[model samples]
Target: MSALHIALYVTGGIAAYKAAPLVRAFIKAGHSVRVVMTAHATEFITPLTMATLSQQPVALDNFAPPRPSEVSHIALADWTDVAIAYPATANFIAKIANGLADDMASTTWLATTAPRIVFPAMNGHMLHQAATERNLNQLGTDGVVVAPTGTGFLAEGYTGEGRLLEPAAAQDFVTYVMSRRQGRLQDVHVVITAGGTQEPIDPVRRLTNRSSGKMGYALAAAALQAGANVTLISTTGRQPPFGITYVPVTDVRQMQQALTARFAASDIVIMAAAVADWRPARVAQEKIKKQPGQETWQLDLVRNPDIIAGLGAQKTHQFLVGFAAETQDLIANAEKKLAAKHVDMLVANDVGKPGIGFGAEDNAVVLLQSGTAPQYLPKAPKTTIAAQVISAIAAARTPD
Candidate 1:
């Protein structure tokens, strides 16, 4: 993530002390922060403390010791890239929701064009009050993000909801919100498949490949960081990170079924799973046993359905991406599959090379698109590769 200019608004509440760490967290993450505080907030945590942490003077008054050239509130509002209200009291929440900017903090919020996030910190009862709920809902309608209050011990000597989030968690929430705003694929629904599918021959035996599902998982993570809602379908048992929808499948048919169910609603589909080309024509209920005279056994195989091609044929508004792990004639074979599968982009790599493809942590790939020359990406971590692929997809889908 890139550095950001963050405006932290401190409101009155016992949780106001938490704002200091939040400021440090943002700065630690390479963001510059400027704090604004309400009168009640000053009682809980001194402006000097915030100023010392943020390395900037805190804005505490609408008037007094004013600048000669510009209004402080408006200047701060205009300078902000993102606004955050930490430990927002019920009074402050209502004021912003209703556009009552009696104080400098509220006024700056009203005047700012940057996106806003509110972290309500009040008594559990006050937070769930009808009025507070209505105000929060109004803020949502006004395009403000309201962070959910954590449930835990409160200042009222009781354990319940409406507790402030820890500095680390709050920082994480801010990062997520900021990423979504800056992300090119914001609100895009993406579906990706990973790992190698298995074709069962009998109850105890199955056929699979060496694909470790690393590349596909990388794509899912990259897309998510780019603010796309992602669904990951995999045969591997690797646990997905938070914020991705996961569906586990064991074979080509199961993967195909999962993809088909989500294809219509997706804006982009990436076929990265190394699906089996063939499966046993019949599955035996029990494991095959060796016999005295049986030296060799024959298994009947049938072609598995081409998953990507089927989705491409049915695509209405989705951008399709397919992957090819080839051993020889990489470019020619990949290009052939690109056109055959009807994908918008084809990512082809030579699995024959050691330490780069299949189960390797790094990859080198040639990106293929219709009528365009192959673009080679040097060997790099799969995460880096995935980010580049997502960036390329975003550029292709929304050309200037």
Candidate 2:
């Protein structure tokens, strides 16, 4: 995400103390912030601290314009790319809901044309009050995005849902909201499979690959940022991003079932999972015991279903993409698979190298497609690579 100019409005609330760290979070993420605090809010968090953290003067009064020419509130409003109401109090929420502009913060909110977000922080009882609910609904109707509050201990010495969200979660929420506003894949449904499928050999043993699912998770996040409704069918148990459908599976059959259920409705499908090619012909219900005199053992194996190929054969309107993790003859093998699987695109990478692919933080891949020259993306962070792959898919999905 690009650096954004954020106009953060702080209102009077006990959660106002968190505004400093919130500003630091935005700055740490490479964004610029300008703070506007209510007089009551200043009692909780000093404007000087906000000014120091934001590296810009805090806007406290409607009449305290530094310039004699331009109105300060209007200038701040015009400069904003996104506006957020941090620790939005009941009174402040009502004022904004009713278009009441008594303070510099409210006036700037009224004047700004940027996308607006609000994070409510108040007593649980007050938050659940009919008046507060009505005000929040009104804010939503006015095109303000109301971020969900964290449920935890409140200032009243009781646990409730009115607590301010932690800094990391709050930043993630903002990122999601902004991504939705600027995304090109709005309303698109993307189904992605990730991680290495495990084939159980016995009660205590299993067969799997080196995949850690980092690339797949990165793809999911990138797809979400592009405004797609994403469904991630993963073998890993890691927590997914805030706005995606997460389906966990252990073997290729389970992954195939999950993908088949969502395939018809999906606009795009990415086969990023390192599915095992074979499974034991017979799995032992109990642990296989090693005979005292035996030096070696033999186990029969059966070929597993080719999950992505099945999807490719059945796909009608879906833009299917597959991954090829090769050790040798990367392009040759990937090109053959591209035709054999009938996928729209193939991402081929050499996993034989050390510290690059398969559980590595970075990756390099060559994009293969029919009737097009091979496009190589140099090694970079998985997140950057995922973004590039998503962009490539988006471009390919569009016709000339």
* Per-residue error (Å), model 1, residue 45: 7.0
**Model 1 agreement with the true structure over 34-143: per-residue lDDT tens digits:** 99999999999999999999999999978756788888899899999999999889999999999998989999999999999999999889989999999999999999
Candidate 1 wrong stretches, greater than 4 Å:
1-3, 12-31, 37-68, 98-104, 150-160, 163-189, 195-231, 234-250, 276-304, 313-317, 326-333, 350-363, 379-383
Error of 1 at 152 (Å): 5.4
Model 2 regions more than 4 Å off: none
Give a tens-digit lDDT track for model 2, residues 317-345: 99999999999999999999999999999
Q: TM per model?
A: 0.73, 0.93
Which window of ten consecutive residues has the lowest lDDT sum in model 2? 62-71
Pairs in steric clash, model 2: none
lDDT of each: 0.92, 0.92
Number of residue pairs clashing in candidate 1, backbone atoms closer than 3 angstroms, sequence gap of 3 or more or interchain: 0
* lDDT score for residue 374 of model 2: 99
Clashing pairs in 1: none
